[model samples]
Every structure is written in structure tokens, then in C-alpha cells.
Target: MKKILILANNDVGLYKFRKELIRELVKDYKVYISLPNGNLIPELEKLGCEFIETPINRRGTNPITDVKLLWRYKKIIKSTNPDVVLTYTIKPNVYGGIVSRISKVPYISNITGLGSAVENGGILQKVTLTLYKLSLKKAHCVFFQNKENEEFLSSNISIGNKRLIPGSGVNLEQYSLLDYPKSKEIHFLFIARVMKEKGINQYLEAAEYIKKKHPNTVFNILGSCEEEYEEKLKEMNNKGIIRYHGMQKDVQKYFRTAHCTIHPTYYPEGMSNVLLESAASGRPVITTNRSGCREIVDDQENGFIVMQQDSKDLIQKIEKFISLSYESQKGMGIYGRKKVEKEFDRNIVVEAYINEIEKINKSIS
Candidate 1:
């Protein structure tokens, strides 16, 4: 069997979002995965991937660490001698792309997001754009998660071949339509890292405002705290404003009772997986008017769209959800499920990769 090597920053995202693609690839290829060690290694290994314990400082901007990562990718590519390389996230995509090009290997780069550094422009953005242009100029194929990302890269850099995909696409099977919850206490869920860029403060402020009036309503928060919001989150939890369930492995359980999902993120996302999964699970979403968040919502149809960074607007939308009758809320969730079924199936993403890999194989032959 031919070999396909994968490079990424973390195992959680790879296993959570792209496990289906990996499963499909393992059936026909010897899949090698290089990423930072995490909880999902055994699960990925079970899917027939040879795991390479790669150390990557995901948030650092140190050039020395980046050089080490580049060196590591070069060594992995040399030793594994894979037919093709697949890279995800920023560090892997940029550094891994360079090594793949120099080693004469066909590689596909997945532009997962522009990230905060790129989105919050500066000298760093210019440096990042320069690196992306240098690295992705010769990629076999570059897949974008959103149209904005595609347009941004196109204007800023020269890419040979690029395509847009549905932000990694939700597994329709895994996130099957759930029964809309039937309860007097309206439950709203927030599923993302606890960070300002993700609009956690907006969610918290809305929670505080909404809880003051609707005492029976519950606001739930899941995922790890990436920043310094733990104390505030805990205080809110104690005050019965929101329930902070830190880093849940099984969010579907939480989804079972959630009436709606709120994602008020301002981050430059390739796509918002949380929104996609929520919609797939037959729960309506209320998110920002940003690219990744807006694409999934059909404003007052599947979910409401709030203005970015405006807690007052978010509170108003939450209040709007509260005003809806139970039947109307359920109808909104049903609409959301149908929307995901039509547009964001993971099989579409899998098929795209398979087709691209087959084309590369044919060219090699």
C-alpha cells in the first residue's frame, strides 16, 4: 500500500473533526500521523495510523522552535518517504509545506483558519502572509474552509490550486438529528474554548442579563479555558448564571437537552465546527455575523445572527429566542438539521480528499 503522512498541531482537532477521513484513508493507504501528543492518540492508532510524537509549540512565535519543527518535518518526510503529505493548521501547513516541496513530495495543505495573528493584522500578518506565499506556492492542492479565507489567500498570495470545503464538514451520522428537547427551562449551550476571541464575554454578559429575568433558564458552557477566564466562569457557575462543565469528552449528552447553541466568536475561523455540529444535532444556533459563523445560520430561520463583539445585541437575540413559542423553537432546530444535511456532510470532505489523492496517484503512475 502507498503511504500518506499527516502533520498537524494537535490530536484533539484531528480526531474530533477529521477521524472519518483518516478512517477512509487507512483502508487504502499506510497512514502516518505526526502531531503533538494528546488524549486521542490511542483512538487514532486504533484507526490504523502510525503516530509520530511531534512536539509543536502551537501558540509560540519563536523562530528557533519553528526551525526545529521544520527540521522535524524534513526528517519525518525523509524517513517515512510517503507518496503524499497532508498538513493542517498554521505551523504544520507552513513549515510542513516547505519541507514537502523541498523533498519533492506532493502535499495537500488545509487552510483551517487565518488565526488571530493573521486576522488581527500587523507586522506579524505580513510575515505570516509572506511565509504562506513561499510555502503554498507549489502545493499539490490547498483546501480552504471558508470563502473569506480563499479570497484572503488569493489576494495575499499565489497558490497553484485551491478549493473551498465546508469547514471540515460535520459527520451527519455521528451528529444525527436529535429530538428537540421538551422542557420548561430553556437551555442555551456555549461550546468552545473559553476565550475573548470566541466571544465568551458576550455569552457571559448575555447569560447574566437573561438569567436576571428568566430564572428558570439555564446557560451551559463546555470546553477548556484557553485564557484567564476560569475565575469569572467559576463565579458565574456559583451564582447560578451559567453551568461551567470544563472540557467534556462527550458533548452529545449535553446536546441532548440543549434547546440552542450560541457561538458569538470573532475569531477568524475556517469554519465553526461547534455551530455545524449543533445544527446537525437539530439545535438552532445564534452566532455572530462573521464569515464562519454567518455561513451556517440563515438569520431568524435556523438561527439568529447577532453583531460581532456586541454583548447587548447578543442579549437581545437571546431574549428573542426566549420570546419564541416551543413549537417555533423546535421548527427552527428542524430547519437547522435540514440545512446541514443539504450543505455540510463530512462525506463531501472525504470524497474531495480521496479524489485529489487519486489524481496525484495517477500522475505519479
Candidate 2:
């Protein structure tokens, strides 16, 4: 059996998002996954993936420690001698790509997101782009989650092979459709990591503005809170302007109960999985008209897309949804469900990955 080694920053992310894809690949290949050891090691092992714990600093940029990571990747790859390698996230794609190239291993990479380095835009962005150009030029195939990122990277670098895939693809079976909740109150839910970049401020601004007018409507936030924004969010929750659900493992449960989902994020994303999961749960979405988030919706048909970073535009769109008849709102959600079924099914992503691996094997033989 061909050995396939995969690299990622953390175990939880690898297990949570790519579990299905890993399951699909393990049937034909001896799959090995490298991530920082965490509680999810057993879960990945259950999927038949050989769990290899590798140290990775998920946050921070200490040059000396980072250089050690590069050397460790080289050591790991040399020992494994895999036929093919695959990687995702920023650090893995950059460091792993370079190591795979140096070891002469056929490898593929997935650009899962353009995080703060690119979003913040300054010296960091310039340095990040330079690193991407150097590391990604030699990969066998490079997959981008959204077209905007694909266009941006292609314009900036000399990439040899490229493929654009729907953001990590949603599992329809798991996030199956649910009947719209029957209630006199319209419930709008926001599910994301609570931070400035995720547009938490715009969401709160809209919620604050809309609450005075529509007393019966409910605005709720369900996410892990960041330290800087935690007190402010808690204050809002105390004021009864919006309810804070905090972070929950079963977000699909929230989706099933919610009438609509709002993701007013301006963050440079790979693709907003929260939007996809909400859409798959048969709920209408309200998101920004930006790259990763916009690609998921049909604007007005499935959900509304508002201007990024503008709270006024977000308020207007939320109000527009409030005016819609119940049937129309439900129709919007149904359209979203159909959209995912047609375009962003998890099976499609797995098939594409398998095809690339097959091509690599054929070329070698």
C-alpha cells in the first residue's frame, strides 16, 4: 500500500473538519496524520489513520522555535518515506511544503484560509506572501478553498498546478435538513469564534439596533469568547439585548432551532464552515459580501449578503429579512439546502482528493 502522510497544525482541527476525507482515503492508502498531540488522537486512530504527534505552535511567530519545526518536519518525512504527502492550514502548508520538496516527496497542499498575516496587511502580509511563493511553487497540486484566494495567490506567485474546491465541503448526512422551528419569535443565531476579525462588533451593532424595534425577535451569540471582547459581550448578555450561549460542541442543535443564521465576518477565510453547516441545517444565512463567506450564498435567494465591515448595511439586511413572510424565509432556507446538495457536498471534495492521489501514483509508476 502507498504511504500517505498528512500535516496539520493541531489534532482537533484535523479530526473535526477532515474526518470524512480521512476515512475515504484510509481504505486505499496507509494514511499517516501529523498534528500536535491532543485528546483527539484516539478519534483519528479509530478512523484507521496512524496518529503521529508532532509539535506545532498554533499561534505566535518565534523564528528560532519555528526553524526547529522545519528541521523536525524534515526528520519526520525522512523517516516515514511516504509516497505522497498532503497539508492544510498556514504553517503546515508553508513548512511542510518546503520539507516535502527537499525530501523529494510528491505532495499536495490546501490553502484553508488567508488568516491575519494577509488580512492585517503590512510587513506581515509581504513576508507571508514571499514564504508562500517559495514553499508552494514545487507542490504537485495546490488547492484553494475560494476563488478570490485562488486569484490572489495565482497573481502573486508562480504556482505550477492549482485546483479550487468548495471550502472543506460540508457533510450533508451529518448536517441533515430540519424543519423550521415553529415559534412566534424569530430567532437569529451567530456562531463563530468571538473576535474582532470575525465581525463580532458588526453583529452586536446590528443586534443592538434591531432589538429596540422588534421586541419579540431574539438575537443570540454562540461562540468561544476572546479576552478583549468577553466583558463587552457579557455586558450585552446581561442587558438582555442579546443572549450569549457561549461555545457548544453541538452547533447543529442550535442550527436546527434557529430561524436564521448570521455570520457578518470580514475575516479572510478559507470558506466559512459555519455558514455551510447552517445552510445544510436548512436555515437561511446573513453574511458579508466578501470572498469566503459570499461564495456560499445565492444572495436574496438563499440568504442576504451585506457589505463587509459596515454595521449599517448589516442592520438594513437584517431588517429586510424581518419584513419577509414566514413562507418566504423558509423558502430561502430550502434554497440554501439545495445549493449545498448541488455544489458543496463532502463527497465531491473527497473524490477530487482521491483523483489527485491516483494521478500521482500513475505518474510515478
> Would you give me the overall lDDT of model 1?
0.94
The lDDT per prediction is 0.94, 0.90
Query: Lowest-scoring 10 consecutive residues by lDDT in candidate 2?
Result: 51-60
Estimate, for each residue in 326-349, the C-alpha lDDT of model 2 and write its tens digit: 999999999999999998998888
Q: Over 4 Å off in model 2, which ranges?
A: none
Model 2 deviation from the true structure expressed as Cα RMSD, one decimal place:
1.1
Q: List the residue pairs that clash in candidate 2.
A: none
Go through the candidates in order and give the clash count of each: 0, 0
Return the top candidate by lDDT. Answer: 1
Candidate 1 structure quality by residue, lDDT tens digits, 9-45: 9999999988999999999999999999998999999
Instruction: Please report how far candidate 1 places residue 47 from its true position, in Å.
Output: 0.7
TM of each candidate vs. truth: 0.98, 0.98
